[model samples]
Target: MDIKDGKIKIAYLSQVPAPYRERMHELIHQDHQFSYDVIYCAKLEPNRKWELEYGNYKMHFLTDVAKTFRHNNTNVWALLKKLNPNVLIITAFKPTMLYGVIWCLLNGRKIIVYNDGTFNSEKSISMIQKQIRKFVYWVASSFMAPSKGTNDLYNSYGVGNDKIFRSCLCVDNSVFDNLPVRDREFTIMFSGQIIERKLPLFFANIAIELSKKIPGFKALIIGDGEQREEMIERLKQNNVDFEFTGFLDQKILPKYYSRAKLFLFTTKHDEWGIVANEACASGTPVITSVDAGAANDLIIHNINGYILPINVNIWVEHILKLLGNDNLYNEFSINALAMVAAYNHQQAAGGLVDAVNYALAEKNKSTQSNTITA
Candidate 1:
């Protein structure tokens, strides 16, 4: 429990490439009191090649495990035991999480489970998976949720108030920085996977409406996914002035963010869209959906950005407001940059450190109390 001097060993197990993992590693490394390790459970078929590469972490392939359930569950535990981590953190309650909880419970290791969004939504995940996730939520020692909505959802599912921690998603300010004070253009940008949930058609519709009204109005669509072809065809059919950049690396992503006058996020079921944070970090005012977790926490209505319901008319009105008033654009831009500071890497890691310290302190107190009673 005396983590002040004790060298804490923590491990992160997740399939996706966590952007904040390197920053977390660096923070822990610089601090002489803690040691951290990451075991990335990566898929084998088509590799997820990160542009801004994260080094200083161990990688484990999940190919063999993918073949069978027995292999996945048993082998992962063997790997965890070999690592001998003091605290195990699972990013999601997937099959990997089931293995993590079982192993941690058997070996008496602390477990932390993270869920960024509402896991039980009919549009997001299957009913069967949601039921299993509920069980996982009940067993975790601590839960790290990326948004207020997600934290509240877990609490609604019977997770203790103390066990649930609010750790919102953050952006690396080094990669995405404040935009320069220049003549803001009549350009709107939408970045992220072109999927059905993102409501790309809505962005296309906004582009069609705004292009006719404002001169030189354009929409920039970045990233590619299953819905890319459909979105492109829709844009062409509507005869909209939009640029489709097919998948960008983290290094090259800044160019897209810097060029845009405003960022439009229209995700229908996103738990906490980190792209919104990236856009805000770039000093571009954002128009995000009320459903987005980032919007719930970071956006302060007319202060930094606008949080509107899923309606293109409202989006068009907000876009026109930004284009018409340069003074208002500048004001929102300044506030957007200031608002994203609390969601930076340092703040996120600081929260993690505090959570670990709190959990360990409570654990030690309970142990001492039990010893006295015995």
Candidate 2:
């Protein structure tokens, strides 16, 4: 378990912003058995704050390639070769998995590719890309997906069940553990990008209906995206009492989780919403769509939270039920907090370490058996 002298070196190649990359890096690094390094393909210069905070990790800021191409073939293999990582894990499919699988095969390094889920029907890749992804799945030593749905997607591409493992997204327990206990204000909070897919308008409408029934009913929308202006205008037009925080700092987000009575996740389709985990960790129960990846994993319908259809009217009834019944709300909140323990950082890190160990052991056994045959 000794991490010193780099017992296990991990190289993560990502084009995403620093917050996500750094969070994953820190989760892995916390384990004494692993030493992690990140190769960030800076399509845009990282936030100054991110650079200042993550200054210690080995970061490669490249501007030559566009984000799409970087995800596909960003010379991550060249960097992987230099790091000589014992285990290589690629997030998302396509170019990253495609390149990482080839590099690991050529170099005899163990590889695990993580898929939150395969691309949605609307976002499905080209036939050529699907063929390439199938090949990547075939070559990878193991595959780690965040949800059963994602695992099924990998299997659909001919990846064996043994090669695929579920590693659901997680939150740092410490962040939630320290959240200040506050009175629930009978408010529902929706904290994700304002996009058509997320169906924020549905939640806004439900909130408007609930406000008429329950005096203190309100909704808080936190995040901005393509539909921000339109959503804002709609909210104003409807005269819904809601707070638009735009984008709040991660440090300040726990407070919102503490204050809200319920977390409303209206995404009609999501691979896995990590914000659901954040909500649970903050001791707030969530009312989420059955379509969310995390909903299947974390939410026990009527136990932890309700998993309702994506209909606004149905959502309104569920909200009113929770508002009128204190026992139901308290029960959900308590159960939700208890459920968060399973998705804590320690559990996730342990799952990753176990997956890596199994992949490495299988590789070693295969090598030794070949030597014996020779």
Candidate 3:
């Protein structure tokens, strides 16, 4: 907690080397204020197709866990023991992170727990699960959150402003900048895995309705998953003109994201849809469901985009309205760019450091109080 000669040794426990998070980690590593190391449970998940680009930073991957989608407590414990960090950052509430929490508790080290979940996404949590989260919240020295929904979630568990820090869930928005202005390609676009929660069939339904009113309604579908075939079949049956680009690399995504007139995110629940961030960064307006975590922070209703319920009729109405009205679409596009400008990698890294510093400061204060009592 004393920062041991001006650098607090920090260890982060994460699920994977997520592309969006890797950049933020690079920025945090560049900061001279703290010694940072990211210990990943795995290199990639079973579903992800990310092309990870590791930076010149301290990164350790659990080899045994990398092969499978599970974490070994022994590996996690051994790594934490070896790191012996002043503060440990836990990125999720899984069993793997629980092991880290227990290690931190036994070692008397400070802990900073990051929360990105919202009540809507966690509606099925049992009472026991809530109690476990409450316990984790109690053990944490500080909390890091990306959106207001996550902040409110922490507040609901009795966390106060003093212990909460803002680390926005962001991507490199600058990448989308400076692309040659070209005519928008697709009338509406949907990006993300074609899984049940993403509601790809619902998007197809919207496309069907829109094609009835608008001439030549073309939809763009990006990414792939178990539901890809079904989604495609539905779209075909509806006679909707569409294109499906299966699981593109991170670098190639900007071209598609930037070309769409309206980015449609009809998800049942998302912690924070990074695709929405990508869409806005590309100067394309978005129409997302209210259940998306980005709806709380990034997409302002009727400003950058519309955050509506999962009603097909309503989605079709808004899509038709935006596509028909050029003035409104342009206004939304401009606003989307302006709104996403604030959430960048730099800001996210700074927020993590702030949370770490706050935790160390609180630990030092507690140490002083104990010393006085003694």
Candidate 4:
């Protein structure tokens, strides 16, 4: 239990090597509080197009022999056994990770469940699935959450507030600073996959409606997916001035954010939208859906931006209001940057360390109690 004597060995199991997560893990390694190892199920998920570089921390990728795998495979068990870490952090709930949880239970290793799911996003869970999560909740030593909504989710599952830790979902804020200023050519922007859940068509509809009121209104659409062609067709038919940039890399993505007047996020359901952080860091206001998990923590209603339900007419009205008033737009933009300042890589790393230390101490107490009874 004495950290000065020896470091805690931790195995952080995740789905992919996302750039934002790698940044946080790099900071955790620099802290030198624990021997941290990041174990990824795969190098990248099929749906993602991020170009990732591994960080300074120890990383292990489970071999996915199956050519068509969803998230994980059975190889996690062998790698976990070989690592034999003192603590295990579970971020995904695939069968492989479920088995890993069982393995940790048998070996008496502490398990911390890191989740981003909110009450709104998980409202439609079947009874059997809810029971499964309830079991996992009982077994986990502690929980790590990003927002108040996620905290409410754990509380609803009967997990006490004391056991929940805050590790805000964040990105590297440095990348978004001091960029070359460009003309705000695009009046509105939508940055995410063009699939059904992201509501790309809804964004197009809003843009079409706005163009009718504002002269020469232009929109910027970033990302590509199965529904890209259909969304593009809709915009073209309505004579909406828009440019579609398909799947931008993380490095140059901020350039577009800087050139846009506002960001529109209309996801049907999202645990956390890191894009909201990027837009705010660039001093751009966000108009996001209430269903997004970040709405509760990142976006302050009427301060930084407005969080409203997914309705075309309502969204169009807000967009016109913000664009028409220069003073109000400047106020929202300034407030946005101020609000997102706390969400950075260093703060996220600190939160993770606090949770790890707490879990280790609780596990030690449980061990001592069992020994005394024996």
All candidates: TM-score: 0.85, 0.83, 0.93, 0.92
lDDT of 1 at 255: 58
**Alpha carbon deviation, residue 37, candidate 1 (Å):** 1.9
lDDT by residue for model 4 (184-228), tens: 888899999999999999999999999899887899999999999
What are the candidates' C-alpha RMSDs?
A: 5.6, 5.9, 5.0, 5.2
Best by TM-score: 3
Off by over 4 Å in 2: 1-6, 17-24, 30-35, 43-52, 55-73, 118-125, 177-182, 362-374
Q: Given candidate 3, what's the lDDT at residue 362?
A: 37
Q: Supply the global lDDT for candidate 3.
A: 0.82
- lDDT of each candidate versus the true structure: 0.70, 0.68, 0.82, 0.82
Clashes of each: 0, 1, 0, 0
Taking the tens digit of each residue's C-alpha lDDT, what string does model 3 give over 145-232? 9998888889888888777878888888878852322376678888999999999989888988887888767889998988999999
lDDT of 4 at 184: 80
* lDDT digits (tens) for residues 1-374 of candidate 2: 22238567776655554343355456666655567776655545322222224624455644433544335555676777777787777775646555766777777777777767643532466787677667766666776766777777876777777666556577565576423324665388888878889897887777777777777566788887778888778777877787888877777766677678788988878778878888888778889976888776787788878899878788888877876787877778788888877665444555565567666773532211110000
lDDT of 4: 0.82
How big is the positional error of residue 162 in model 2, measured in Å on the Cα after superposition? 3.4
Candidate 1 stretches with Cα past 4 Å from truth are: 1-6, 43-49, 58-73, 119-131, 177-186, 362-374
Q: Estimate the overall C-alpha local distance difference test score of candidate 2.
A: 0.68
